[model samples]
Target: MLYFIGLGLGDAKDITVKGLEIVKQCSRVYLEAYTSILTVGKDALEDYYGRELILADRDMVEQEADEILKGADVSDVAFLVVGDPFGATTHSDLVLRAVNAGIQYRVIHNASIMNAVGCCGLQLYNFGETVSIVFWTDTWRPESFYDKIKKNRDLGMHTLCLLDIKVKEQSMENLMRGRKIYEPPRFMTVSQAAEQLLEIVQNRRERGDDLAISEETICVGLARVGAEDQVILAGTLRQLASCDLGGPLHSMIVTGHLHPLEVDMLQIGCPGRNPCIKYSYQDG
Candidate 1:
């Protein structure tokens, strides 16, 4: 049997009881490392689970999935993922591959950022759509996500901006030269996301497009979510751009029409008391 298990957003101990038991029972355990990461390192997880984990990079999972699935029909194999197994579409593809290989599989669900993001005090139902912000190069900046954010804002719904994470990626030059060299892992921070967002806003202003967001727009920045040292700050886009949110695995929420209760909850994460007061409809 092939088991795809989700390790919740924290340390190794965050795994559900059933998931942990299955992990212990599996003969081979592979940890999917590219999509998202847990707060603790591989060693910490190994220590807690009493089993060593094979780190599966993007190449191994995408290019050599068969090797991981090999013999799964005869033996138990476990593929562990940070957050829920379905959080990323890649895992779903793996399940499809498993089915074609005549392997039986089971998915164990866990908390993913998609739902845990509500800890920031935004109503889940008020969110329209979630968009990913990728790392932009000098010649390859994309602003399509800006339009999605605008659509959500126009409908009076919040937008959840998932920051990008680049792991085991090859440089363009290296790829062209046929070199297997890998670049260092990078996790986009809330500050970086804000800078790119503001750049898009500036470009739209230059083009005389009706701006959906502005420098004064309210945004909530969350870092190291589900970890003990997690930080959530509510402020304007300008304030967030200058604020230091500390470590990685950050996410940002672009709020639309705020409810009074939401304003009250998010105010706790603000720099000062009643910081969200400026965003209150009553103020306008």
Candidate 2:
């Protein structure tokens, strides 16, 4: 049997009891590292879960999937994901491959960003489609996520902007040289995403369309959520663009006009940034 276990938002102890039992029962345990990451390191998880984990990079999971599934045919194998197994579509692809291979599989679900974003005091049901923000290169900046965010905003629904994370990625020169050099991992923060969004807004403003999101739009920044030291802040998009959210694994939310309950909940969540400062177009 193949187990897809979710290591929930916080630390190693966050794993469900059933998931932990499966981890110990499995003969081989692999942690899918390229997607979202847990707050603790692999060693920490190994010590806590009492299992030796093999780090599975993107190449291993995407290109050499057969190797991962090989043991499941003979014995129990567990593939652990940072959030829920299905949080990233990549895992779903893995499940598809496993199904095609006729491998018996079970998914153990846990708290993923999809639902954990509710910790920000926003109504989960109020959210519209979630969008992912990718890293922009000088030659390859894409605005595909803009339309989705715009669509959600136009419908008066909250937009959850999942920031991008680049892990175990090779540099262009290394790939060309066949050197196998890996670049430092990067996790996009809420501030960076806001800056890029404002850039797109500026471009649209120049085009005289004026539908772009502005800095004054109410935005919430969440960092290291589900962890003890998690930080949540609410302010204007512009204000949040400048705020230091601290550490990796950040997410942003562009809120629609809030309900009275949402306003109250958000105020309680953001004790320091209360009054939730609004940005102005005039400042821009």
Candidate 3:
């Protein structure tokens, strides 16, 4: 049997009791490392779960999936993910492959960013389509996510901006040279995402495009969510672009319509920031 387990957002102890039992009993356990990560390392998880873990990088999970599912037909194999296994579409493809191989599989779901993001006080139902912000290069700067944010803003729906995480990524030069060298892993900061967003807003202003998001738009910055030391900061987009929330694994929310209660809750997170929160409706 193939078991796809969610490790939750925080630490090793965050694993569900049922999931922990399965991990303890499983013969081989693989941790999906590229998509997301936990506050603790593999050693910490192994020590807590009382099992050895094999790190399944992007290449191993995508290119060498057969090896992962090779002996699953007979014995139990566990695939661990930082958040819900289905949070990333790639894991769904793995399930499809398992189905085609006639292998039995089970999914143990847990809290993922898709839902845990509500901890910031934004109603989950209020959020529209979630978008990912990737790292921009000198030659390549994509603003595809801006349109989605605008669409959400137009509908008075919240926008969850998932920051980019580059793990075990290789540079084009290394790839072209057929080298195994990997670039340093990078986790996008809230500041970085805001800078890109502000740049897009500038371009829109220059081109006379419809403006829903602006410097004063209410935004929330989250860091190391689900951890004990997790940080949540609420401010304007411009303030967030300059504020330092500290640590990795950050997420930002571009708010649209704000309920009275939401405004109060988010205001509490703003501390001393002025004009704490402003939504799209305020532009009117």
lDDT of 3 by residue, 66-163 (tens): 99999899999999999899999899889999989989999999998889988878899999999999999999999999999999999999999999
lDDT of 2 by residue, 17-106 (tens): 999999999999999998888889999999998779999988899999999999697799999998899987788888888989999899
Task: Go through the candidates in order and give each one's C-alpha lDDT.
Answer: 0.88, 0.86, 0.89
Each model's total of backbone clashes:
0, 0, 0
**lDDT at 227 for candidate 1?**
84
State, as a TM-score between 0 and 1, how close model 3 is to the true structure.
0.95
Error of 2 at 231 (Å): 0.7
* Better lDDT candidate (2, 3): 3
Clashing pairs in 3: none
Local error of candidate 2 at residue 132 (angstroms): 0.8
lDDT of 1 by residue, 230-283 (tens): 878888887788777787789999998898889888866533222432332322
lDDT of 2: 0.86
Model 1 per-residue lDDT at 48: 97
TM-score of each: 0.94, 0.94, 0.95
